[model samples]
Target: MDQLEFAYPWAFILLPLPVLVYWFVPAYRSREDAIKVPFFTEILRALNETPKVAAGLLSPKHWQRGMLILSWMLIVSALAKPSILGEVQTREDFGRDVLMLVDLSGSMDEADFTTADGSTLTRLNAAKNVLKTFIAKRSGDRFGLILFGDAAFIQTPFTADQQVWLSLLEEAQTGMAGQSTHLGDAIGLGIKVFEQNPQPSEQQVMIVLTDGNDTGSFVEPVDAAKIAAARGIKIYTIAMGDPTHVGEQPMDMEVVQRVSQLTQARAFIAIDQAELDKAYQLIDKLEPQQYSSASFRPKITLHYYLIAIVLALHLLIFSWMTLRQMFSRAEVANE
Candidate 1:
């Protein structure tokens, strides 16, 4: 629990107003004719009291005076608006949701991606390196991962935890799911994952990276792209390794281009790490990081409780005075 604070501390200045009035203002009086009783003088002499009582002060009993002062103090405190202040916390509003659909076909093992330092890495490793950098730069984006080859598998669901996402990404290996490429199945799986979550994302994006044509899939790649397009999901395609070469694991440049075109996104052909980095850089620029932050403290008001206490005190004092007066009247009647 945090410390109590007042909304209007200046209200305390009114606490002494009643005292000031009592000291300076005179009591109200009215004139009346005195009774011409035969024993009035004798009664005053026997009681040893004077009869010159033209004016008198209306003073309350000690208890009544204390209660009145206490009630006034309570009213002032309520007027001040006491409240408890809570600690401040921050919240971040994310801007986008990005899903990466990576291809882990056997062809990805080709050691053809040469970096600027004259070092060679497999296609999957190269893509992973570029992706690590890219994902880090996208600060306010929720990311999900889909690895596909013989079959498609979701490695990580949508999350803002970048470290956990990267950890899952590292666990992926070439041909782990299967050696054959199933681009259409992967796309379908990605769409199904989005449907299952159904969480509202500001912007939805899917980046598809592959090195081979769709060998066998229940749904065709272009048809899957059309479905994704209708669902407002943009698909960016990346064809790894030399696009011109035709071998056992042939690159499907046409399919990649068509998929990107149908979904209103871009396509890239990366033969080296530099080109891969440039592709991610372009996408980063296109979908720039956007977010906002705010801080606030919770407040609990206490004035209502104070008002209730004042009401209870007034009722207590009223009941006590009423009972005392009733007993006093009964005693005089018995006498």
Candidate 2:
């Protein structure tokens, strides 16, 4: 809420002018030119009245004087330029840019992760569920999504619209980018996205969620991490599969660890949904989202409203006086 104020309080000085004139100014008086009328005495006798010469000035009725004074006061108030001081407002500013690399390899289709209700879901779906909550909690953070299997591609560019990013994440299916995990190329693409849309004074972060070791990639995962480190991008890794498994679907914990260590970040192993959520929560703690706000009070003039009131008052008085004169004439005519 805001309070009403006056821009020019000095305008109120004019309110006393009519009073001062009444106090000191002489009363208006004018003398008629004396031209002798030969039949003036006869005319006076015909009207059955005797005439006297000396007279005083007649003044307005009390109500008429009051209305004039009120109108003058309103005009002065309008000249004062009444206004209101508006309230303060705030806004959010981003402090971090987080790009997520999710693995879409065939191994991610395994339904081994358990939920709170004792139901099992695929590694990718469990990740998405945890990510939904994670994104919701992270306000004022820019997000980018990269999905990789045999090759790497950007699913969504860096954006502040978390809902749009989540919707795009929902569209990701296992093996859509082909079966083998290409973690290195995904990291490379993440770095490129960060470079392409660089935000000044913002911390860049990369989160890798994968299920298996990289079977082959154009660039090695360690080499990509080194590039990320050189550009000051922190890489957080989460291995979201069974590390004990051997053969084609074996999880490479060392690669995930090395990538995190190279970028001065952390690594986690999430065998179930709970640990997966914990990983994201810890990430949230490490790179917290922050907001900055600005506030101001706007001034809006209200002089026009006061002027309108004055006009309406004058019209009302004019209408009443006109009706009074009309009825008085009608009465005289009837008599």
Model 1: residues with Cα > 4 Å off, grouped in runs: 1-81, 196-199, 244-248, 303-335
- Per-residue lDDT value at 268 in model 2: 95
Cα lDDT for residue 18, model 2? 92
Per-residue alpha-carbon lDDT of candidate 1 for residues 1-335, written as tens digits (9 for 90 to 100): 58889999999999999989988986788877567888988999999998785765678889888888888999999999999977887888888788999989888888998999999999999989998999998878989999998899899999999999999999999979888889899999988877777675758889988888888999999999999999988899988888866224567688889999998999998889999999999999888887777998889899999999999988887898899999999999999
Error of 2 at 253 (Å): 1.5
For candidate 2, report its TM-score: 0.62
Q: Candidate 2: what lDDT?
A: 0.88
RMSD of 1: 6.6
Residue 220 accuracy (lDDT) in model 1: 96
